[model samples]
Target: MTDISTETRSVVIEREFPFPSEKIWRALTQPHLIQEWLMKSDFKPAVDHRFSFNADWGSVDCKVLEVEPNKTLSYSWDAYGLESIVTWTLTPTGTGTHLRM
Candidate 1:
Protein backbone atom coordinates (compact mmCIF):
# COMPACT_ATOMS: atom_id res chain seq x y z
CA MET A 1 0.00 0.00 0.00
CA THR A 2 1.09 3.57 -0.68
CA ASP A 3 -0.01 6.82 0.90
CA ILE A 4 0.33 10.33 -0.34
CA SER A 5 -0.59 13.71 1.06
CA THR A 6 -0.68 17.25 -0.25
CA GLU A 7 0.20 20.43 1.58
CA THR A 8 -0.47 24.04 0.75
CA ARG A 9 1.14 27.20 2.05
CA SER A 10 1.21 30.88 1.24
CA VAL A 11 3.85 33.57 1.63
CA VAL A 12 2.77 37.18 1.49
CA ILE A 13 5.00 40.19 0.94
CA GLU A 14 3.57 43.64 1.56
CA ARG A 15 4.81 47.06 0.60
CA GLU A 16 3.47 50.57 0.81
CA PHE A 17 4.25 52.74 -2.19
CA PRO A 18 3.82 56.48 -2.16
CA PHE A 19 2.29 56.19 -5.63
CA PRO A 20 -1.19 55.79 -6.92
CA SER A 21 -2.50 52.31 -7.55
CA GLU A 22 -2.87 53.17 -11.21
CA LYS A 23 0.83 53.88 -11.50
CA ILE A 24 1.79 50.63 -9.84
CA TRP A 25 -0.67 48.77 -12.03
CA ARG A 26 1.05 50.06 -15.15
CA ALA A 27 4.44 48.83 -13.97
CA LEU A 28 2.98 45.38 -13.35
CA THR A 29 1.06 45.02 -16.61
CA GLN A 30 2.87 46.96 -19.31
CA PRO A 31 5.68 44.95 -20.86
CA HIS A 32 8.09 47.83 -21.55
CA LEU A 33 7.72 49.21 -18.07
CA ILE A 34 8.03 45.78 -16.49
CA GLN A 35 11.46 45.42 -18.09
CA GLU A 36 12.67 48.37 -16.07
CA TRP A 37 11.94 46.81 -12.68
CA LEU A 38 11.26 43.13 -13.26
CA MET A 39 12.15 41.27 -16.41
CA LYS A 40 11.64 41.46 -20.16
CA SER A 41 8.25 39.99 -20.91
CA ASP A 42 5.35 40.09 -23.33
CA PHE A 43 2.89 40.25 -20.45
CA LYS A 44 -0.64 41.53 -20.89
CA PRO A 45 -3.19 42.35 -18.23
CA ALA A 46 -5.80 39.90 -19.47
CA VAL A 47 -7.12 36.62 -18.15
CA ASP A 48 -5.86 33.45 -19.84
CA HIS A 49 -3.26 35.45 -21.75
CA ARG A 50 -0.06 33.50 -22.27
CA PHE A 51 3.32 35.22 -21.89
CA SER A 52 6.97 34.63 -21.26
CA PHE A 53 9.81 36.37 -19.45
CA ASN A 54 13.17 36.17 -21.20
CA ALA A 55 16.56 36.73 -19.57
CA ASP A 56 20.21 35.94 -20.08
CA TRP A 57 20.00 33.04 -17.65
CA GLY A 58 16.68 31.48 -18.65
CA SER A 59 13.05 32.10 -19.47
CA VAL A 60 9.93 31.64 -17.37
CA ASP A 61 6.72 30.46 -18.98
CA CYS A 62 3.62 32.06 -17.54
CA LYS A 63 -0.08 32.60 -18.09
CA VAL A 64 -2.29 35.33 -16.75
CA LEU A 65 -4.97 33.84 -14.49
CA GLU A 66 -6.76 36.93 -13.30
CA VAL A 67 -6.74 40.69 -13.91
CA GLU A 68 -8.54 43.50 -12.15
CA PRO A 69 -7.30 46.86 -13.33
CA ASN A 70 -5.68 48.90 -10.54
CA LYS A 71 -6.74 46.26 -8.05
CA THR A 72 -5.58 42.71 -8.48
CA LEU A 73 -3.60 40.46 -10.82
CA SER A 74 -2.82 36.76 -10.66
CA TYR A 75 -0.70 34.58 -12.87
CA SER A 76 1.00 31.23 -13.12
CA TRP A 77 4.80 31.17 -12.98
CA ASP A 78 6.56 28.03 -14.14
CA ALA A 79 10.33 28.03 -13.98
CA TYR A 80 12.74 25.13 -13.98
CA GLY A 81 10.61 22.31 -12.55
CA LEU A 82 8.68 24.36 -10.01
CA GLU A 83 5.20 25.72 -10.58
CA SER A 84 3.64 28.50 -8.58
CA ILE A 85 1.03 31.22 -8.78
CA VAL A 86 1.85 34.89 -8.22
CA THR A 87 -0.88 37.23 -7.14
CA TRP A 88 -0.68 40.97 -6.67
CA THR A 89 -3.27 42.97 -4.77
CA LEU A 90 -3.49 46.72 -4.46
CA THR A 91 -5.60 48.64 -1.95
CA PRO A 92 -6.27 52.33 -1.89
CA THR A 93 -4.70 54.10 1.06
CA GLY A 94 -4.63 57.52 2.64
CA THR A 95 -1.00 58.00 1.71
CA GLY A 96 -0.84 56.09 -1.54
CA THR A 97 -1.45 52.42 -2.17
CA HIS A 98 -0.97 49.19 -0.24
CA LEU A 99 0.55 46.41 -2.28
CA ARG A 100 0.50 42.73 -1.40
CA MET A 101 2.29 39.98 -3.30
Candidate 2:
Protein backbone atom coordinates (compact mmCIF):
# COMPACT_ATOMS: atom_id res chain seq x y z
CA MET A 1 0.00 0.00 0.00
CA THR A 2 1.10 3.57 -0.63
CA ASP A 3 0.53 6.62 1.52
CA ILE A 4 -0.98 9.25 -0.70
CA SER A 5 -0.62 11.83 2.07
CA THR A 6 3.14 11.35 2.07
CA GLU A 7 3.40 12.15 -1.60
CA THR A 8 5.34 15.23 -2.57
CA ARG A 9 3.29 18.40 -2.70
CA SER A 10 4.71 19.73 -5.91
CA VAL A 11 7.33 18.83 -8.46
CA VAL A 12 9.45 21.40 -10.21
CA ILE A 13 12.11 20.35 -12.64
CA GLU A 14 14.78 22.52 -14.15
CA ARG A 15 17.02 21.41 -16.95
CA GLU A 16 19.68 23.02 -19.06
CA PHE A 17 20.62 21.84 -22.53
CA PRO A 18 23.71 22.60 -24.60
CA PHE A 19 21.89 23.31 -27.82
CA PRO A 20 20.82 26.30 -29.82
CA SER A 21 17.68 28.05 -28.57
CA GLU A 22 15.94 27.51 -31.88
CA LYS A 23 16.65 23.76 -31.71
CA ILE A 24 15.34 23.41 -28.20
CA TRP A 25 12.38 25.57 -29.00
CA ARG A 26 11.42 23.33 -31.88
CA ALA A 27 11.69 20.22 -29.76
CA LEU A 28 9.35 21.76 -27.21
CA THR A 29 6.75 23.20 -29.56
CA GLN A 30 6.81 20.92 -32.57
CA PRO A 31 4.34 18.05 -32.11
CA HIS A 32 6.45 15.45 -33.91
CA LEU A 33 9.57 16.19 -31.91
CA ILE A 34 7.55 16.40 -28.72
CA GLN A 35 6.12 12.95 -29.38
CA GLU A 36 9.66 11.65 -29.88
CA TRP A 37 11.12 12.81 -26.57
CA LEU A 38 8.25 13.68 -24.26
CA MET A 39 5.55 11.11 -24.84
CA LYS A 40 5.24 7.75 -26.56
CA SER A 41 1.65 8.32 -27.71
CA ASP A 42 0.22 10.59 -30.39
CA PHE A 43 0.31 14.37 -29.78
CA LYS A 44 -1.10 17.34 -31.64
CA PRO A 45 -0.22 21.03 -31.13
CA ALA A 46 -3.35 22.98 -31.90
CA VAL A 47 -4.98 24.91 -29.10
CA ASP A 48 -7.51 22.78 -27.21
CA HIS A 49 -6.34 19.70 -29.06
CA ARG A 50 -6.89 17.05 -26.41
CA PHE A 51 -4.37 14.22 -26.35
CA SER A 52 -3.58 11.33 -24.11
CA PHE A 53 -0.30 10.01 -22.66
CA ASN A 54 -0.48 6.33 -21.93
CA ALA A 55 1.49 5.92 -18.75
CA ASP A 56 2.06 3.10 -16.31
CA TRP A 57 -0.65 4.48 -14.05
CA GLY A 58 -3.10 5.48 -16.75
CA SER A 59 -3.75 7.81 -19.66
CA VAL A 60 -3.67 11.56 -19.04
CA ASP A 61 -5.26 14.24 -21.15
CA CYS A 62 -3.65 17.62 -21.81
CA LYS A 63 -4.51 20.74 -23.75
CA VAL A 64 -2.30 23.57 -24.92
CA LEU A 65 -2.92 26.89 -23.17
CA GLU A 66 -0.32 29.28 -24.43
CA VAL A 67 2.77 29.41 -26.63
CA GLU A 68 5.31 32.15 -26.92
CA PRO A 69 7.95 31.96 -29.63
CA ASN A 70 11.19 30.49 -28.20
CA LYS A 71 10.21 31.63 -24.73
CA THR A 72 7.22 30.24 -22.92
CA LEU A 73 4.79 27.35 -23.14
CA SER A 74 1.87 26.49 -20.87
CA TYR A 75 -0.80 23.84 -20.84
CA SER A 76 -3.52 22.30 -18.79
CA TRP A 77 -2.83 19.00 -17.05
CA ASP A 78 -6.32 17.61 -17.33
CA ALA A 79 -5.62 14.56 -15.22
CA TYR A 80 -5.48 16.82 -12.19
CA GLY A 81 -7.61 19.61 -13.56
CA LEU A 82 -4.64 21.92 -13.08
CA GLU A 83 -2.99 24.46 -15.25
CA SER A 84 0.77 23.98 -15.49
CA ILE A 85 3.19 26.51 -16.85
CA VAL A 86 6.51 25.70 -18.50
CA THR A 87 8.87 28.43 -19.55
CA TRP A 88 12.10 28.34 -21.51
CA THR A 89 14.54 31.19 -21.44
CA LEU A 90 17.19 31.36 -24.13
CA THR A 91 20.37 33.31 -23.73
CA PRO A 92 22.98 33.49 -26.45
CA THR A 93 26.36 32.40 -25.26
CA GLY A 94 29.74 32.71 -26.90
CA THR A 95 29.73 29.05 -27.83
CA GLY A 96 26.10 27.98 -27.82
CA THR A 97 22.68 28.79 -26.54
CA HIS A 98 22.14 28.89 -22.80
CA LEU A 99 18.76 27.26 -22.37
CA ARG A 100 17.09 27.59 -18.98
CA MET A 101 13.99 25.50 -18.36
Candidate 3:
Protein backbone atom coordinates (compact mmCIF):
# COMPACT_ATOMS: atom_id res chain seq x y z
CA MET A 1 0.00 0.00 0.00
CA THR A 2 1.05 3.53 -0.62
CA ASP A 3 0.23 6.65 1.30
CA ILE A 4 -0.08 10.23 0.15
CA SER A 5 -0.17 13.36 2.27
CA THR A 6 -2.31 16.33 1.32
CA GLU A 7 -0.66 18.76 3.69
CA THR A 8 0.23 22.14 2.30
CA ARG A 9 2.99 24.54 3.23
CA SER A 10 3.76 28.18 2.57
CA VAL A 11 6.98 30.06 1.96
CA VAL A 12 7.09 33.74 2.76
CA ILE A 13 9.73 36.30 1.95
CA GLU A 14 9.73 39.86 3.29
CA ARG A 15 11.87 42.76 2.22
CA GLU A 16 12.15 46.47 2.85
CA PHE A 17 12.59 48.69 -0.16
CA PRO A 18 13.67 52.30 -0.17
CA PHE A 19 10.77 53.15 -2.45
CA PRO A 20 7.15 53.99 -1.83
CA SER A 21 4.44 51.39 -2.09
CA GLU A 22 3.02 53.04 -5.15
CA LYS A 23 6.34 52.76 -6.96
CA ILE A 24 6.76 49.15 -5.87
CA TRP A 25 3.18 48.50 -6.93
CA ARG A 26 3.94 49.75 -10.41
CA ALA A 27 6.82 47.30 -10.75
CA LEU A 28 4.52 44.49 -9.72
CA THR A 29 1.39 45.38 -11.67
CA GLN A 30 2.73 46.94 -14.81
CA PRO A 31 3.53 44.42 -17.52
CA HIS A 32 6.55 46.28 -18.85
CA LEU A 33 8.05 46.75 -15.45
CA ILE A 34 7.27 43.15 -14.52
CA GLN A 35 8.99 41.90 -17.62
CA GLU A 36 12.11 43.79 -16.63
CA TRP A 37 12.35 41.94 -13.32
CA LEU A 38 10.39 38.72 -13.70
CA MET A 39 9.52 36.66 -16.73
CA LYS A 40 7.95 38.14 -19.84
CA SER A 41 4.28 38.36 -18.95
CA ASP A 42 0.98 39.77 -20.14
CA PHE A 43 -0.19 40.48 -16.63
CA LYS A 44 -2.95 42.93 -15.83
CA PRO A 45 -3.93 44.22 -12.43
CA ALA A 46 -7.58 43.35 -12.73
CA VAL A 47 -9.36 40.48 -11.10
CA ASP A 48 -10.27 37.50 -13.29
CA HIS A 49 -7.87 38.61 -15.97
CA ARG A 50 -5.96 35.63 -17.35
CA PHE A 51 -2.35 36.05 -18.33
CA SER A 52 0.86 34.14 -18.86
CA PHE A 53 4.53 34.47 -18.14
CA ASN A 54 6.81 33.21 -20.86
CA ALA A 55 10.39 32.08 -20.37
CA ASP A 56 13.04 30.28 -22.38
CA TRP A 57 12.08 27.04 -20.66
CA GLY A 58 8.32 27.37 -20.99
CA SER A 59 5.32 29.42 -19.92
CA VAL A 60 3.24 29.78 -16.79
CA ASP A 61 -0.52 30.32 -17.01
CA CYS A 62 -2.04 32.51 -14.36
CA LYS A 63 -5.20 34.41 -13.48
CA VAL A 64 -5.71 37.45 -11.34
CA LEU A 65 -7.48 36.49 -8.14
CA GLU A 66 -7.38 39.75 -6.27
CA VAL A 67 -6.08 43.29 -6.50
CA GLU A 68 -6.16 46.20 -4.09
CA PRO A 69 -4.42 49.06 -5.79
CA ASN A 70 -1.02 49.60 -4.19
CA LYS A 71 -1.75 47.38 -1.24
CA THR A 72 -2.19 43.79 -2.38
CA LEU A 73 -2.21 41.51 -5.37
CA SER A 74 -3.02 37.83 -5.60
CA TYR A 75 -3.08 35.42 -8.49
CA SER A 76 -3.13 31.82 -9.47
CA TRP A 77 0.14 30.38 -10.77
CA ASP A 78 -0.17 27.14 -12.68
CA ALA A 79 2.85 25.48 -14.20
CA TYR A 80 4.37 22.03 -14.53
CA GLY A 81 1.41 20.36 -12.84
CA LEU A 82 1.87 22.45 -9.70
CA GLU A 83 -0.94 24.92 -9.03
CA SER A 84 -0.44 27.62 -6.46
CA ILE A 85 -1.43 31.14 -5.49
CA VAL A 86 1.08 33.96 -5.36
CA THR A 87 0.28 37.00 -3.30
CA TRP A 88 2.11 40.27 -2.85
CA THR A 89 1.44 42.70 -0.02
CA LEU A 90 2.87 46.18 0.19
CA THR A 91 2.90 48.28 3.33
CA PRO A 92 3.90 51.89 3.55
CA THR A 93 6.83 52.37 5.87
CA GLY A 94 8.62 55.30 7.35
CA THR A 95 11.43 55.09 4.84
CA GLY A 96 9.62 53.44 1.98
CA THR A 97 7.68 50.20 1.60
CA HIS A 98 7.61 46.82 3.29
CA LEU A 99 6.99 44.10 0.77
CA ARG A 100 5.79 40.61 1.48
CA MET A 101 5.56 37.79 -1.03
Candidate 4:
Protein backbone atom coordinates (compact mmCIF):
# COMPACT_ATOMS: atom_id res chain seq x y z
CA MET A 1 0.00 0.00 0.00
CA THR A 2 1.17 3.51 -0.75
CA ASP A 3 1.90 5.62 2.31
CA ILE A 4 -0.28 8.65 2.71
CA SER A 5 0.00 11.38 5.24
CA THR A 6 -2.17 14.36 6.07
CA GLU A 7 -1.34 17.75 7.48
CA THR A 8 -3.23 18.94 10.51
CA ARG A 9 -4.55 22.45 10.53
CA SER A 10 -5.11 24.42 13.67
CA VAL A 11 -8.40 26.21 14.17
CA VAL A 12 -8.58 29.52 15.90
CA ILE A 13 -11.80 30.75 17.49
CA GLU A 14 -11.90 34.15 19.10
CA ARG A 15 -14.61 35.52 21.29
CA GLU A 16 -15.18 38.33 23.72
CA PHE A 17 -17.10 37.77 26.92
CA PRO A 18 -18.43 40.45 29.18
CA PHE A 19 -17.21 38.60 32.22
CA PRO A 20 -13.86 39.06 33.83
CA SER A 21 -10.86 37.01 32.87
CA GLU A 22 -11.13 34.80 35.92
CA LYS A 23 -14.75 33.99 35.23
CA ILE A 24 -14.08 33.20 31.61
CA TRP A 25 -11.09 31.15 32.57
CA ARG A 26 -13.21 29.15 34.99
CA ALA A 27 -15.81 28.53 32.30
CA LEU A 28 -13.12 27.20 30.06
CA THR A 29 -11.19 25.12 32.57
CA GLN A 30 -13.70 24.05 35.16
CA PRO A 31 -15.56 20.91 34.14
CA HIS A 32 -18.91 21.76 35.68
CA LEU A 33 -19.00 25.27 34.28
CA ILE A 34 -18.02 24.03 30.84
CA GLN A 35 -20.87 21.54 30.90
CA GLU A 36 -23.33 24.32 31.55
CA TRP A 37 -22.67 25.87 28.17
CA LEU A 38 -20.66 23.64 25.84
CA MET A 39 -20.93 20.09 27.09
CA LYS A 40 -23.81 17.70 27.55
CA SER A 41 -22.53 16.12 30.71
CA ASP A 42 -19.85 16.20 33.35
CA PHE A 43 -16.17 16.61 32.51
CA LYS A 44 -13.14 15.84 34.58
CA PRO A 45 -9.72 17.36 34.32
CA ALA A 46 -6.55 15.50 35.20
CA VAL A 47 -3.48 14.37 33.33
CA ASP A 48 -4.54 11.77 30.77
CA HIS A 49 -8.13 11.81 32.03
CA ARG A 50 -10.60 11.18 29.25
CA PHE A 51 -13.73 13.30 29.02
CA SER A 52 -16.72 12.51 26.83
CA PHE A 53 -19.35 14.84 25.44
CA ASN A 54 -22.53 14.12 23.54
CA ALA A 55 -23.25 16.83 21.08
CA ASP A 56 -25.52 17.41 18.11
CA TRP A 57 -22.80 16.13 15.81
CA GLY A 58 -21.92 13.11 17.94
CA SER A 59 -20.00 11.92 20.92
CA VAL A 60 -16.47 13.21 21.34
CA ASP A 61 -13.76 12.05 23.70
CA CYS A 62 -10.91 14.33 24.66
CA LYS A 63 -7.99 13.78 26.95
CA VAL A 64 -6.57 16.50 29.10
CA LEU A 65 -2.98 17.14 28.16
CA GLU A 66 -2.03 20.29 30.02
CA VAL A 67 -3.61 22.99 32.12
CA GLU A 68 -2.43 26.41 33.22
CA PRO A 69 -4.37 28.63 35.55
CA ASN A 70 -6.10 31.63 33.95
CA LYS A 71 -3.92 31.45 30.88
CA THR A 72 -3.50 28.28 28.81
CA LEU A 73 -5.04 24.86 28.39
CA SER A 74 -4.30 22.04 25.98
CA TYR A 75 -6.24 18.90 25.28
CA SER A 76 -6.33 16.11 22.73
CA TRP A 77 -9.65 16.05 20.87
CA ASP A 78 -10.12 12.36 20.10
CA ALA A 79 -13.21 11.84 18.02
CA TYR A 80 -14.07 10.32 14.68
CA GLY A 81 -10.70 9.71 12.97
CA LEU A 82 -9.17 13.03 13.88
CA GLU A 83 -6.85 13.56 16.84
CA SER A 84 -5.67 17.09 17.35
CA ILE A 85 -4.57 19.40 20.07
CA VAL A 86 -7.04 22.10 21.17
CA THR A 87 -5.64 25.02 23.05
CA TRP A 88 -7.46 27.88 24.76
CA THR A 89 -5.81 31.06 25.81
CA LEU A 90 -7.40 33.83 27.81
CA THR A 91 -6.28 37.44 27.93
CA PRO A 92 -7.49 40.00 30.37
CA THR A 93 -8.97 43.10 28.85
CA GLY A 94 -9.70 46.32 30.64
CA THR A 95 -13.24 45.26 31.44
CA GLY A 96 -13.74 41.85 29.90
CA THR A 97 -12.12 38.61 28.84
CA HIS A 98 -10.61 37.93 25.47
CA LEU A 99 -10.57 34.31 24.49
CA ARG A 100 -8.40 32.94 21.72
CA MET A 101 -8.15 29.43 20.39
Which scores higher on lDDT, 3 or 4? 3
lDDT of each: 0.94, 0.64, 0.96, 0.80
Question: Candidate 4: how large is its RMSD?
Answer: 2.2
Q: Give the least accurate 10-residue stretch of model 2, judged by summed lDDT.
A: 4-13
| lDDT for 29 (candidate 4) | 69
Candidate 4 TM-score over all chains jointly: 0.80
Please list the residue runs of candidate 3 whose C-alpha ends up more than 4 Å from where it truly belongs after superposition.
none
RMSD in angstroms, all models? 2.1, 4.6, 0.9, 2.2
Relative to the true structure, candidate 2 reaches a TM of 0.60
Q: What tens-digit string does per-residue lDDT give for candidate 3 at 1-101?
A: 88976787899999999999999999999989999999999898999999999999999999999999999999999999888999999999999999999
Ranking 2 against 4 by TM-score, winner: 4
Where in model 4 is the C-alpha error above 4 Å?
1-5
TM-score of every prediction relative to native:
0.92, 0.60, 0.96, 0.80
**lDDT tens readout by residue for model 1, 60-98:** 999999998999999999999778899999998999999
- Which numbered prediction scores highest in lDDT against the true structure? 3
Model 2 residue runs over 4 Å out of place are: 1-10, 80-92, 98-101
Q: Per-residue lDDT tens digits of candidate 4, residues 1-101?
A: 98868976777999988888888777876767887888774565566777887778898888888877788888877788878888888888887888998
Best by TM-score: 3
Model 1 Cα shift for residue 67 (angstroms): 0.6
Backbone clashes in model 4, listed as residue pairs: none
